[model samples]
Target: MAGKQALNIVKIKKMKQDANPITVITAYDYPSAKLAEEAGIDMILVGDSLGNVVLGYDSTVPVTLDDMVYHSRAVARGAEHTFIVTDLPFMTYHGSLDETFRNVRRLMQEGHAHAVKMEGGAEIAPTVHSIVQAGVPVLGHIGLTPQSVNQIGGYRIQGKDEKDARRLIEDAKALERAGVFAIVLELVTEEVSAAISAEISIPTIGIGAGRGCDGQVLVFHDVLKYTSDYREKRFVKTYANIGEQIRNGISEYVNEVKTRAFPAEVHVFAAEEGVIDQLYGKGKAESES
Candidate 1:
């Protein structure tokens, strides 16, 4: 088991400054987090995308603060060195500053996350500042924030036109000003993403936003092909079809059971013939009595 020393934010900052692209992946449970740590991944996000990938919800809005805390704690326990960033689920930070502080504190103290990520731009900058002042690191998220999917109309690419692109650039700058360690650019145009990466002093972590970012992030389930029901997205590249392998392995077990070939002599326990005969005699005596 790995020890519980979290990755330093300074290292990630230096990586961005040195132009060394960072790598981040989402892990929802202990097994996934442990595997990511063993693989030496740079960061692990206990994203609310867990709702879609793990909890069977159609959208992230259905996720709650309690849900994030539960999964974040599991990931934190498994990941020792890798930096852990957990999402503040929808509506957790959008209300009063006291409410935001309470929830963010719970995520850090209870969930054991190194950092917390929240959506929105300038509108939430004050909340971001408050959290940072309270000694919690904040990772700002803009450009196709999933929590805003209903308001934005759907899961479409952001920063397409000049007006939207300009606003995105401003949002990134605002978040950087608000003291966010990094920003997640999701479903933005490549040109816009590259521009923001160039403009921002902090790192830009991209998801479905092309390769020009300071780092790239993807869900573990998508990378490992963990399920056959998962929808393939343009940005997702399936590395290993573990789902198919699992299916085949289970089928083999089923066939072996049907054929009575699984539990061979080597799989059974043995006793002396005299002991077996004594057991049989005891049973006969009891029945006769």
Candidate 2:
């Protein structure tokens, strides 16, 4: 496949204007990022959802800026040609502006990310504006922010009611005005998501927010079935059951080993005729002498 064209805010905005649906995937490691790039993904997000899918955490709350930097570095190395965005993680951007700038700098300079994605609405708009002013691109996320799961009362659909829908629209507008290149609408009702997309000039990337979005993103593990125990999300449409395939392959290998079927003649290396015997005999002779 051809190499991915490097993306920037101009190109991303053009994609939205042209009605070309952008493709995004969350990749936590080198291999997944490389594969996603090869598969022609438009963007790679090093989401804090790695806390759940890769690190075995129940939620994204515990993910730290260091964790994000480590994973984002891996993804950046793997997909140099693709646009990469790294999450700021829980509380990383909620504190002082200095702290937020430090986190964004780490993600960009150390982690090698092209931009940073922050989860919140108008409340975080000023922070986003400040970061953007400092020459750091920001991707805003609203609707069911995972970092606020406890406060939001679990992973439920957001903006289902009229009041919430209006709020979501305003959030999108606020984010756009704050200089966010794009926004991610997660778990909002389809109608509300569509309204937000229409209300904002920047692209809206949806995860569980239906097809009304200008772009769609899903976790790498979710799309490829990386773990058998991963409770399938309604929004995720698994493209491959690699977990099952891996399990079956491993089982076959185990069975072959137990039955002495593996390491067959073709798999084994043979020395010259009588070479082993000569070595042993020579060693014995030397010892005896």
Residue-pair clashes per candidate: 0, 0
lDDT of each: 0.91, 0.92
TM-score of 1: 0.93
Best prediction by lDDT: 2
Question: Model 2, which residues run further than 4 Å from truth?
Answer: 272-278, 282-289
Best by TM-score: 2
- The collision pairs in model 2 are none
lDDT for each residue of candidate 1 in 154-236, tens digit (9 for 90 to 100):
99999999999999999999889888999999999999999999998899999999989999999999999998686889998
TM-score of each: 0.93, 0.94
What is the lDDT for 260 in model 2? Answer: 97
lDDT tens digits, residue span 43-87, model 2: 999999999989989999999889999999999889989999999
